[model samples]
Every structure is written in C-alpha cells, then in structure tokens.
Target: MSRVSDTEPCGTETAVRSTRPKDLTSRSSFGVLGTLYSAGEQGLALDAHRSLSRSTLLRLRDRRTGAFIEEFTAWADGFGEYRVRLTARARRHYAHHHACYRELYPDIDTPVPRPTDGAHGGLVDHRADRDPARNLLREADVLVLDALIRLQGGEIGRLQKPPIGRYQRGTSPEIGAMPPGLLYREAEKLANSRKPISRLLQHPDGPLVAVVEVTSLLPWAATGSIPLPALIVLTTRGRDHYESHLDSYRRAYPDLDLQLSRHTM
Candidate 1:
C-alpha cells in the first residue's frame, strides 16, 4: 500500500474528492478473534485491547506456552468457518473477559473506589451514562476497526486446534458443506456492526454512526488511514447491504451525514 503524502494530511475533503469512488460502509469497533487458556482447557474469545505493546505481547505468549491456540481452536469447528459463528464466540469471550476491564471501572464499591477511567472498562458497557471512554470509542471505533482489518491474514499467531476432520460415512452428505465466501461476509457484517451498535447502546440519544469492513468490491475506500464517514455501506456479492438502512437513517436524521467504505466481495 502507498503512503499518503506528507503535504496532504489525512482526512481532508479535497483528498476525499480526489480519491477513488467512495465506499459508504464505516465500522467503529473492531472485533478480534483470539485464544485464551484456563486450566487445561482452551477457548476462543474476542478482545477489545487495541494494540499490545511488545512487552505485553511477549508476556502473554510466554505465559501460555503455546497452549492458548490449541484450546481455543479445539472449542469448535464453526469458529473458523463462519462470521456469525465467530460473533457468537466473541460474545462469549467478551463476557468472560469482562472481569479484566471491570476491575478498572468496578461497579461495586471498593476501599479505593477505583476511578471510572474510560480506558479500562468504559468502552464495553452500554449502560453507563457518564462514560467519556464510550464517547471516545464511538468517535474512534474506526481505529479499532482498521487495526483488525489489517490483521486479517496473520494477526493471531499462536497454536490452534487442528483443521476440521473429514466427514464420517454415516453422516448426511451435506453435513460438512460450507462456502468459504460465507465466512468473509459474516466477518464483514460483524466488523461493520461493532461500532454502530456500541454507539447506539452508549449514546442512545446521540447521532447514528455507520460501521464497515474492507473487502474486494470497495478497494478505493479501503485505505486504512482515512477517518471514516458517518455512514458506512460495505459492498459484497456486487450489492450494498446497508443501502436501505442508510436510507432509513437518513430519512430519520438528515443532519447526520452518511459515510461509506466499500470492500468488493
């Protein structure tokens, strides 16, 4: 990928016009698939931590002894196959990891009355009314999103369960059939919806935001450096899924402009 010019700072209207035809899908929150080890068992989970410092990354790897991947990948075959299945796995991961973030923004009172800094636990909770982290996340979900997209090919480097085995003779013939493209689509949807729903939950009365993913159709808009628009409409299978939603949101709130990011399928 070519670097943007130093003279032209990213996120300019002039730059937008000069760039290729815009994609409308924009995503705020990025969901990452990871493996965690507990006891002898391993599990798959989603992580909100944006980037791990080199030290933290090394520490996590050292602690696990390559066990995290084996446990998580073995949890199920569906995880690597479909985006929806991955979503389910991520939800489970979030619930489990909630404790880590919760420590920073403990709902329960402690002797220290741990400060409610948004960085630790603020982004995940939708019900907190005074969470600046929530607002910041709503504004910067794209940051999380872009990082995850760039990591598509080799982000999670760890041991994992073996690939799905061949079907048994007694099972139905179609039992193991699943299209590869389907996983990409679902991954796109999950990635796209992350920030929007987080926004809705965090700021029930605030403006609407669009979330999207990078795919083949909207290559022009996939540049990770750009600040995403208000409305995002990613392209897959040569059609835009978010078109009607965008139109409906526009009709309801014209003041909030639409932003798009297209990824060709």
Candidate 2:
C-alpha cells in the first residue's frame, strides 16, 4: 500500500478514465475514485490485492485491528488504465444496521451509493438523500443505551398474554415464533419505521433514570488511548434528581467506562 503522493498530477483522473465502464459517465467514475481515495487517506490500509479477469481486487483493513473495512474491485482498460468499484462487503456494511465497523472506524467516509443500469438502457441514479453515517451513529448509540439498561438489572422484555383469537392467516414464521412480549414487537415496529430505539427504552417510572445520548463511539474498545464516549444525560427533573441513581449505576458497574454530563432543556 503505497502512499498516494501529494505532488502527483492528475493521478486520480487518469485512474478513473482507465477503469471507467461503458455505462458510467466521467462524473460517476470520479465519484468512485473519491470513495477509494478518502478511505485510504483516513488511515485504512490496503490489506489484500489480487488480480481478477480484467481488474484488480483491493481490500482495505484497519491498521490497528487488521479487520477488513472495505473492498474495491479495480478495472483496467487495454491501455493499462484503472477504475474502481466497491463490491459486496463495502455495500452490505453500509446498507445493514451493524454497528461494529462504525464503532471501530468512526472517521471513515460513508460511501457514495453506486449507480445501476435501468431497464431502458440508460443509467439509473440510486443516490439517496438520507445520510447512512448519521443513521448508523444513532443505531450505535441505541446499542450502548441498551447495554446500560441491562447493566442496571432491568429486563428488556417480559412475557405477555397472547390474543384470545386463533392465529391470523398469512402469518410469517418469525411472527408465529416470536416470544410473547411488547418489547420485541415495539422494537420491530420502530425498526420498520426507521426510528431510533432509544426513545422506546425511556420510562420515567422505570429503573432507567435519565435519557442518554452517546457522544462518541471510541469507547467501544476495552483498552485504548482513545477517550471514552460521553453520555449526555437528559431528565425532566434537575440533574440532582438523578444523581443517586447515576451513582448507583457507576458503583454497580465499575467496568463500564463512560463520562457523564447533564444537559437540561
């Protein structure tokens, strides 16, 4: 993995033109190049390089953990020029709700959604107006919030009585097999609605004393120079109202590394 020289002239432009597919215009080709370049510049190392039919495969790994972060398939024309495409691994990571990758590498850029060919032979743009990175960040925060609830001896789900009527028609296997509980069903509803689950966990009368927002992701690691994530505590009452509960939580779970701050609105 050689460092791309700052002095190099039109290096990315040349690479894009060389590897550009017949269906991709120059603008889209540059977009792909930008994705690859941004990842490399953000401290991800090129871990694997292999030759494919008319292209090269490159896998980027985290230098610290040696985990595969992104994979790019680079194509070359007959004149020895290059262009890159983000393959399965990179695409799936962004599309799914998994938080490990973003938790590990928070600074890496969110990839530009790839364009696809339409039925009528013209290029169809699939660029979304939504920000995947922001969504992932909220998801990661919810996971941390869930962990905090569990640490405080709160059960996430409880058994509930089933409906009096018989099973409905066209019920999916998952729904039929679902454990009787409001938590699971509510979680599914929130997920389907693309809403954050942090709000679902809130109960003013429950053991959870305050609403929390994870201000950082670096704290997911057990040991690192990186500072722990900060928790912004929001409560209807003053901060002093929750001090006892917060202190108890800290005393009960000393291993949980978090910096707590209060913000009232």
Candidate 3:
C-alpha cells in the first residue's frame, strides 16, 4: 500500500467526523421541536378550542354581528341573510356581556395592569401571551387554514361575520365614512401611538420588524407606502376584537412576513 503524502494541503485532509447517534438523547431535536411548537402556537391551540368551544365561538360571533345588524338593519335591508350568517359569533360574545372596557366600560380611566416579574425578567411570558396559549394558536391556524382550503376548492366554512365587505352600510359607518385623506389621518394617529413603526435595537441584525396598528397601513397604502410589514395587531378589549380584523389586515400587508397575533386585545 503506497502511503503518506506531505504535499496534501491541510484543508483537503478529511478526518473522521464525530457522528452522534440519533436517538432520544439528541439535544438538537428538542430545540427543533421547541421551535416547531412555538411556531404552531402562533395560531389557535387545542386548549383554546375547549375554552372557546364551537358554542362559545358562535356566541361571540353572533353577538358582535347582531349588534352590527341592529345598527344598520335599515340600510342593509336586502342583506339580512348575509348578516345572519356572519355575525353569529359576535352575538354570542357580546350577548348580555355587560363588562365595559376599562377605557369605555367605565367613565373613569382604569389603571393598566403591570407586567409581572418572571425567570426571564420582563421578557414576554409565553404563557401570558395568551390564555390557554395552545388553544388560541390552534384556532387561529384553523381560521387561516380554512381560508386557504376554501381557496383550494374546499367548501368555505361558515364564517361568523360576513367579512368587512358584507357588513351592512348602516352598521359600518366608519368604512365609507373615511375619505382617502381621513384614511391617512386615522392611520397616522394609530402609527403615532399604538402602531409606531420602528426597528427595535434588540433585533438590529435581523429583518426589520415593526409593531404597528392594523389600521396604520390603511394610511400608508394611501400615502404610497405601497408595501408594509405584516403586522401583529393588538387591542385592549379582548381576543374576540383582535380576531375580527385578522383576515382583512393580513390581506392588506402580504409582505413584511409574519403571523398576526392578538397580543394586547
């Protein structure tokens, strides 16, 4: 056997690489699984399904939709069928629900709850991110997945609300009420306060991210910011309020990729 060659560049030498056996002891798998679960949590999770069961979902949807229907029953005279189908969930959530928002519920402003200390110290707690986090994410995933499925020729699930487009003219005075100019104004107000668009220093090396109001882009689009970041919108009210805007807002910002979550509201 002809043997050694000193002229071989050190870079070209191939040594026996450490090959860890794949099994339960693999640390890498846990990390990957954690990431997958985190990603999966971005939509509604199973526990949420139990908490916000089909009955509860219908109640919330119908309550909200019914309120809208009542307000615009006359103007939306011909669209009764549409409203009935859409606002089913809203009706449930708002039905006899007398809890006023801290802001609007009581005439006096209510103090915001302080964030709690944790092992991560001010880092957003995954659990606090939502109640029954897994369930919420699963539900959201189902919502989007259903939409895509319908686009792929599957039957569309009956949406609790008839989308923004189907809202009766009477119920949605805010829609046509905003002229192009006002869209800019409202969007700017939201941008300035709840939806400020800026890069956080913590993520300087990554893709630019901004937490903006779902309505901010309405103005940006009007002002010719043709493209905007995909936003995660929040509301002070509750999850129900936030979910109401998800589809329309997602369609608004197709780029600046990310999932839209209901953080505050």
Candidate 4:
C-alpha cells in the first residue's frame, strides 16, 4: 500500500476524494470500504474495478501466523458499493484475537491529569475482546488472550488449537424411511446438546472502550498505530454495552463523540 502524503493526512476528506475506491461513496463509513477486509477484499476489489453480480467470500488471515484464520462474505450495499455484513452468529462465533481503538476526550478520566500529556498523546491501550478458550484449557495450560494482548512491544507469535471435531447428525435408515417430521424430532436432541452461548472474555479483561473492528468491512479503519481502549464489556454476538448506550452517552455527555477506530486490525 502507498503512504499518504503529510499534506493530506489519512481519513481526511481531501485524502478520501483523491483516492476513493470506484464503488465507495464519500458518505459511506470506512467500515463499508471493504478493501482492507481480507475476507471480502476479493469481491470488493473486483467490484472496485468493475461490478459483481452476486456476493462472495473474503478470508481474513492470522496477523501473526499468516495462516488461514476465518472468513466473511461480501455483497453490494445496495448503494452502488460493496461491503461486508456481520451476521449475529458469525460475530458471536468468530470475532476475536484482534486489536481495536478508542478515543478519550480531555474530559474522560486518566492517570494523567492531562490525558494528552503522555507518549500516547491520547491514552492508548490494547485489549482483546473475543476469542474463546479451547475446551479443557486451564489457566496454567495456556497463554490466554487477556495476557497476550497486554504484552507490549514484543515479538509476534502464533497459537493454534488442535483439530476440533464436530459431531455429525444423520437419521437412521429406519428413520429415513419415515416422514421428515421424524428427523425434525431427532433434531431437538441435537439442538439441546449445543454448547451454551458465551462471549469468551473474562471480567476486567476486555476493552474499556468499544471494539469496533469486529463489525468492520474494511481493515484500514481499525488497524495500524491507533489509540484504543482496555475494555468495557463483552457481550453476546450483536451488541456491546458501550455501543448500546452510545445514544444515552451522547445525550448525557454531549461533549464527546465515541467514534470507532479507523482501521480493521
């Protein structure tokens, strides 16, 4: 990727207009840009150059390992542009092991009386909000995400879980001979057997500010040299506490604007 000139800082209007992707709208948020999202990049890239008739998958690789990690699908945003949508299930299941940002106005609390006085200049911190533990992973059995994320200025490393096996459900030949309701009845057992829903984060370990990248369709908006939060809360797939109360916060503390990070790390 080429670097932006100092005369036009990144994320600025002039910077955006000079290098807008063919399909993106100036009104669209960076999260809708789609190019930086590995999972949706190809389809977004194709759409940026031309147009795509249908949606497609874009794979996101491990930032540390360069290994195939997870994927997301990309389709048109119905505004003559392509973007990625985060399904509730996918967000609950796959969003994790990444870094995010949060901005604190001078009014927010900080160790420094002047929140802007430190090297961070804006009180930057790293937090890992998702990524569940593999089964049977005791605290001693691993380098947990909470600890790993707080690890500053270190060499990057990779961690892989052993192949996870999932049980397949199939109707017995005798049951197959019956009407489909029989299989539907059998499905109840499987449904009841599913693991309970979990956000996969421990108390006091998530980002103090909201993690916006999990929902990002583009990467640049949430990655690279940004100031982020330690954590506030980690909930189920769809909502974060900070996001849920954003409107109230704006009403109560009208002076602040808690914007999401500008990159998708």
Candidate 5:
C-alpha cells in the first residue's frame, strides 16, 4: 500500500471510487453488472429478486455487443444502461453503503465513507479487531458479503438485506466508530430505511452464492497516534477468490478495502 497523507478522507488506501465521466457516451454502457451496488438491508438470507422485479422501468443490453438496447429513462442521465427504476439502490451503493457509515442516501458526488479519519484515527471501529463477537461479527460478515456480491455481481443467489437496526454498540473499546448513514435528506429518505438492501445487480434468475466475511481488517482506533491500518478483506471463499478478479471490483468501487480471506473455500 502506498503512503497517503493523513489529512484527507481515510478510505482511499483501497477505496472504491467512480471516475465519473464528463459526459456519457456509447462506451459507458459496457459496465453491466457492477454498475450498481447496495448495502444489504434484508440480510444475505432473503429473496432480493422479488424486490428488483417490482421496478417497472428496466434496462436491457445486447449480450454480444455489450450495448445498451434500453437506456436509463429516469434516475440518472449518464450512468450507462443501468436501469432507471431502482436508481435509489445504485445511489445507496455509492453513498457510504460500505460499513460503519452513518450517512444515508447520498448523491454521486458524496465522498466515500471511511473506516478511519484524520489525526484522531479514533474515528474508527475496532469491532472486527478487539472483539470478534459471533453475533455482531456475523452481521458485519453478512453485510460485507452482500456488498461483495453487489459490487462484484457474480452468480451469488438472492440475499435478503440485513436490517440496519442489527447494529449494536460493541463492548470492545476499539469499536467506537460512526454508524452507517447518508448525506442528503431526500436521498436518505429514499434509501432502504423502509426497504431492505438499497441497490442490487443480478440475473433475473440465479442461484445464490453462499459467501460472507470470514475475516476482515478493521482499522484500529489510533494507538497513541499510529496512523490508520491499510484496509484488508477476507471472505468465506478465501483470498484467491477476490485476488483473481479484484480489478473488476475496483472498477465499480474505488476505495474498496478488500484483500481476500484464507478460509471457507
């Protein structure tokens, strides 16, 4: 990992960011599955397909040519051929949908949520570090897993998003970071506060891929001024699972802090 000045946002070490184009062109349609993301609102145990089907306005593409046969009619103007109906979901993905973010639905310009921040570094969660409680860790795991699927768009089966309420205050001293939320009021209201999982990208019919966070690198609260830790990730499928296709995830998500887990298989 390269050294980033500790002054700006703290997630760029492995953050997933969008290099938004000045204007949309035909080539913009190339990103199909990864064009969207979502924070699992229903948990990775529900049928998300049913929710996606509700959207009347949809976008389709030519498989061979990778062109947008159906373009966005609403939501965003130049986000490629991504469907317009569930644009709120896509927005959620970019709007601090990762972890420990309290910001709600945010626009495309909103800054990516960070696990740790400037000099204080205390603005982070050590839950995944000091205390790996089964319940809380599992919840975090489910969220990370669903996020992986949303950003990676593999054959993972429909996962119901976990409710945000599941977030509990951890006894771990290091586990004192911000909560997940959105920046804008309108976008926050539109987010899945009522619904589960804000955004999704999947086949109309596909088998759920059983996966979740097996291990993850939680930036520890500053240990007497030590800087934030480099973002790391490990999943149920092991490290190679992501190592092989990491670039794809980065394309959709810029500050994505994932490495790969060496367990689950």
Candidate 6:
C-alpha cells in the first residue's frame, strides 16, 4: 500500500481549496479525508489499498492537539465506510431511533439502522411486496433516490431541481400555480418507476437534522451498493429549521461532507 500524508497545518480553507472539481469527477471513489479536513480535523495518512484502484484508507487527527480522531475507508466503487465514536448527545438522538427500530421490526437481526442496508436503512422496510403505509415515508425515499440518480447522471445541477415539472409543489411561490393533485400524481409515477429502497431518514418530532447525523456514520446508497454522496434537499421552511439547529447537527455529524440544498420551487 502507498501512503500519502499531509503534515502541514490543516484547516477548512486549505482542505476546500485543495479539493478541485476535477478530483471529484476523475476519481473512481472518494474518501472522508476532505470531509474530515473541512470539519477541522487534520489528515494524518491517506493510503491506497492498491496503486491502480481508488480504494483508500484515511486517518484523521485533531488539528490542535494532534490526538487521533477516526479512520475512513472508501472502496473502489465509490462507497465510503467508517466507524465513528458518537458523543453523548449523538447517542441520545440515536437511542430514540434504535429503540424505534427494535419496536417496528422485532424479527430483524440488524441492531441499528444503516443508510446502506437494503432493509433497515432509513428505518423503513423498502420491499416492493410490503404493504404500503398511509404515511409519506415511502414517497420520501423514492423522491430522494430519484434525485440522487439524476444528480449523479448529470441530469440536474443540484438535488433541489425537480426531476419533472409535475413534481413541483404549487404551494411554493417560486412554482406559481399548478393543477390540483398534479404533484401527487407525478410522485406516484416516479415511485412506480423502480423498486423502492430506503434513501431518506425521517424523524416525526422535528427537522431531519438528527437523522442526518445517523446517516453520516453509515454508508449511504440509493440502491444496492451504488456510491453517492450524502445530499439533502429541503423546502425553504425546512432549510430554515435545519439551520436553526445547525450547531447540534454539526456536533452529531462531525467530519461529514453532507451537501444541503434548497428546493428550486
């Protein structure tokens, strides 16, 4: 394995500037080194598992104290893996979801929800044969998954762009007006396009900021092992609510390069 080190002083400015758009496009996979750096952690080592592949292991440390923080691994397919030591506050948030998972699926062996798990991720059962719920849980996952596929496919500039005009909410001032039930019908059409998978984390109590933290500690996917970065799009109100609790979210999901965007309409 070959090891690449950045021993010079590390900070968010340096890290962001170092990561060129070309790097994201050219690499077969990406690691959390840049994420950690942007989070104010120093990357101690960036090692390649093989010279020819994008698989890598990154070690991070505290920039001020030089204390070891954590390690992140990215596979050649662009799927990222990492184990994080959650803080007390983060554990409190996770505890609620963990308990809910156990209550909802008693027979499932998975102890905790992971974003990559086909069944347990997003705290929802995404099987096509399963009975549909009255809630919007399934629809939310479909929306996010469709958005990711489009974003990765270069069909859109950001996640906020609606995949189709029908998906746009008429209530939004930016979208003007639309026929009644138009958005709902379009969503159903999008949902019917593919087998459902868990791609969103929903918390009944408030904004999705807490669930965002849970996703950061786990591998994210739209379907199967397809590699895509963690990205969230919210309405104007949702974005404001998320920003209001930004500090807590930051503490819970430190060292994550989560992309956030607001809906276009």
lDDT of 6 by residue, 129-214 (tens): 12333333333333433344333333443223454243333334322221111122233344443223222324454442211221
- All candidates' TM-scores? 0.20, 0.19, 0.18, 0.17, 0.19, 0.21
TM-score of predicted structure 3: 0.18
Q: How would you encode candidate 2's per-residue C-alpha lDDT over 168-218 as one tens digit per residue?
A: 223234333332223333433423432333443443343232322221221
Q: Listing every candidate in turn, what is its Cα RMSD in Å to the true structure after a full C-alpha superposition?
A: 21.9, 19.6, 26.6, 21.2, 22.6, 19.8
Task: Note the Cα lDDT for every prediction shown.
Answer: 0.28, 0.31, 0.26, 0.24, 0.26, 0.31
Off by over 4 Å in 3: 1-86, 96-130, 134-142, 150-153, 156-265
How well is each residue in 134-181 modelled by candidate 1, as lDDT tens digits? Answer: 223332333223323333323331111123222122333222221112
Q: What is the lDDT of residue 38 in candidate 4?
A: 31
Query: What does candidate 4 score on TM?
Result: 0.17
Model 5: lDDT equals 0.26
- Model 5 TM-score on a 0 to 1 scale: 0.19
Per-residue lDDT over 164-183 for candidate 3, one digit per residue giving the tens place of the 0 to 100 score: 33222234444333321212
Candidate 5 lDDT, tens digit per residue, 77-162?
65422232213333333332233222111222223433432111111322222233321212222334334434343322111112
User: Residue 83 of candidate 4: its Cα lDDT?
Assistant: 38
> Model 5, stretches more than 4 Å misplaced?
1-143, 146-205, 209-244, 263-265
Of candidate 6, the 10-residue stretch with the lowest lDDT total is 21-30
